[model samples]
Target: MATESARSERAGGVSSLRGLAGGGVFLPGDEEYDRARTTWALAVDLRPAAVAFPTSAAEVAAVVRAAASAGLRVAPVGTGHNAHPLGDLTDSVLLRMSGMSRIDIDPDARRARVEAGALWLPVIEAAAAHGLSALHGSSPDTGVVGYSLGGGVGWYGRALGLAANSVTAVELVTADGSLTRVDAEHEPELFWAVRGGGGANFGVVTTIEFTLYPIETAYAGMLVWDLRDAHRVLSRWARWAADAPDAVTTSYRHLQYPPIPEIPEPFRGRQLVIVDGAVLADDAEAERILAPLRDLGPELDTFGRVPAATLARLHMDPEQPTPGGGQSALLDELPPAAVDRLVEVAGADSGSSLFLAAELRQLGGALGRSQPGAGAVARLDGQFQLITGGMMVGEFAKQTVADCERVVDAMAPYSRGRQYLNFQEEAVDPSTGYDASTWDALLRLRKNADPAGLFQANHEIPHR
Candidate 1:
């Protein structure tokens, strides 16, 4: 392996990286370097020593070997949605895998083989054509491999469980430049580690195979009410969520829309409380399940039988790149008192400075139960998930960091003292995302898989 001096010498140029087979190498001064290094989260500005786009798993291995020879680490990025947590990348090689986006759906087997670079949108569309659906997150644009490896929680999560749990196999390039396939029957430990321990920790994943559900349509949509009813809506949601069946997955958001043309006319420059979710049942069953909330008389109700492909847009997440700050936490429960506390801090009358969207996602059902021989993060022990974020624009950008912390601080009492790895915006202890046993097992497995410490990027598991 190359030494520190060798790495420093190679940092000035990308000639060695360019010599690699089956990939594109980009240096700081390269024409595409800036665009290649840009991420979905506009807040992240990365300046890596080099950026490489590998077309195949063999090419990925070649890049890994090259980086090892240059005494540099590799940070594999897909769609770059979680780039903010990666911190500095000066000494690393950013591996851009968006070029290998290929999805093969096996409707007979009820599974989809997704390449690392594939996004959820294409996969969802492909599955929908076969009247099937994968456990995909809210945003269709999010990368599949990254989201699945980090324990994806989607609109159908309550019914089908996490996306990570659905993964049946993974193909990756190990630290020694060897391409390996892992699954329950092969490399079982590594399979467990990658499922929810966070990808890019033990190796660079090239593709993943996950199971899909047989469903063409379901009852899904959003219900909106003026901010005046924030407390009442939230309280009802909390109570409903507690006893909600496995068929329903829901969340409530307190939104403060900016006075911008991008926002809808009625919602722009206003504070609104919205309840959004999906029920994996027919219209009649869904209506029965959602009858209580419907009886509350929302100002706007859009619930109806919708195609599974359309579920991704229910949250109304920005389809284009966005600049924002985000923070999240897993909560033990959202009791009445906790609901009051949240409304007091993030409600319309709260005069809050940083939060543009504050939400509490219902957690339970399949998410609360661990499957036999599950992955690293077997189950989420919490009852609800709290997420708060703000658009980072102009003055708000500077205050976002502090404001995020302030919200987290205020909600500390109800926190489970844990966080979801995918939603974390900063580097946090891996222990926070797992139990003691799982954390320890992950550390041991990471060390064994990447003994040279070649792959250490965002939310990395320390070798020691």
Candidate 2:
């Protein structure tokens, strides 16, 4: 079905990529091309002309050079966990980093250096092996570089700050196919842009070096309640978390689990309210600190001590692809009145989606402190990030997004006028997601570093 001219153009692009290191390119007609281009977000259907699995940073540079010469857009792909709201690549040269998977933990330095292609699972497992833990996102399946680059916020964010703040160094391949190392001491401008600025705005990160902490165990998990108690639970949770220590982070969701055999009978196909949370720094103090929450009436309680590797199960975010839409806002505060209003909009009584998950992460503590000389990672200081997401398909996608915005707009009173980069579902103007000053600062850095606009992927910060 290809036009002769278009076919010729693609052939030319394919030919130019053939000699680039690690392996040959995956062209459109190739049998494995479709499988290789699939992203974790089921809704994203990528149609890249080619996918290049670079074995090294030099090879990544080579791919960028070839794309530049062929006038093709370049994108970086890691664990493909671009989550809903973040657009995926189309008709671009996907510089898939899967081949670059590598992780090294320096016990003495209490730091870990990982390739851009690696997922957080390996990092958590590796860190746990040494009785240490890295500041990673909720899902262990998320790519470290991809998440950290977007200022990853996890259960420990309040205690440790966004994951990007823990990064010490980055090795990136820029627009001109040149390699550059960024950190507080080197390429300070690019360093600022890469931290929490989102991906594709700067360059393709090859590897990242970040600090890790020593944490052996914590009290974590969730409690499930019937939909009838959703309003009451929401109000109680709002008040309890307001005074919660930085060590604790929690989120509540109004969900209707499908009646599948995989789902427990008690929760199957039933509307329910569940609280998922974690206590990061202390095990003994967790019980006393979280007692107020635990005392709230709930049908089921599953909290207990757990290792970091199994933390992803706490939220139990589906691993497989599902059609969904999501939107997010950074919250300045969450009071009981605000929670009551939120319940009015998306609670069990609302005949919207069968599932609606609203997360509230406690902020302050280390999250409010700036990492000295952290360049870009130091820009984030949001008090709390609120996200409302749902799984919907086909014609309902638009309705879902609209429904989400209603909740977002209704909660504007408590918002910080910022959005979480990861939860964004649409192609948003880069300026709207960050604080005005933060956006301006990122723009200044992008202008100086990735002035050519080469790397563009999830939640992209375009070259100005």
Which candidate number would show the highest lDDT if scored against the true structure? 1
Tens digits of per-residue lDDT, candidate 1, 41-113, equal: 8888889988898888989998999888877789999988888888778778999989899999999999999
Among all candidates shown, the one with the greatest TM-score: 1
lDDT of each: 0.87, 0.76
- TM-score, every prediction: 0.96, 0.91
Task: Tell me the tens digit of each residue's lDDT in model 2 across 1-464.
Answer: 44778656855866688667566578778888887777677766777768888889889888988887875778887866663433434446877887888999998899999998898878898988888888777776778988888777777877887788788899988889899998888977777778777546778889999998887777888888887788788777777776778888777777777778988787888888888888875656888877777787677887788886677657777766666668778787777778887888877776666556666666666666777765455544466667777766776677677778888888999875666666666666656666677778887777776676666666666567
lDDT of 2: 0.76
300 Cα displacement, candidate 2 (Å): 1.8
- What TM-score does model 2 achieve against the real structure? 0.91
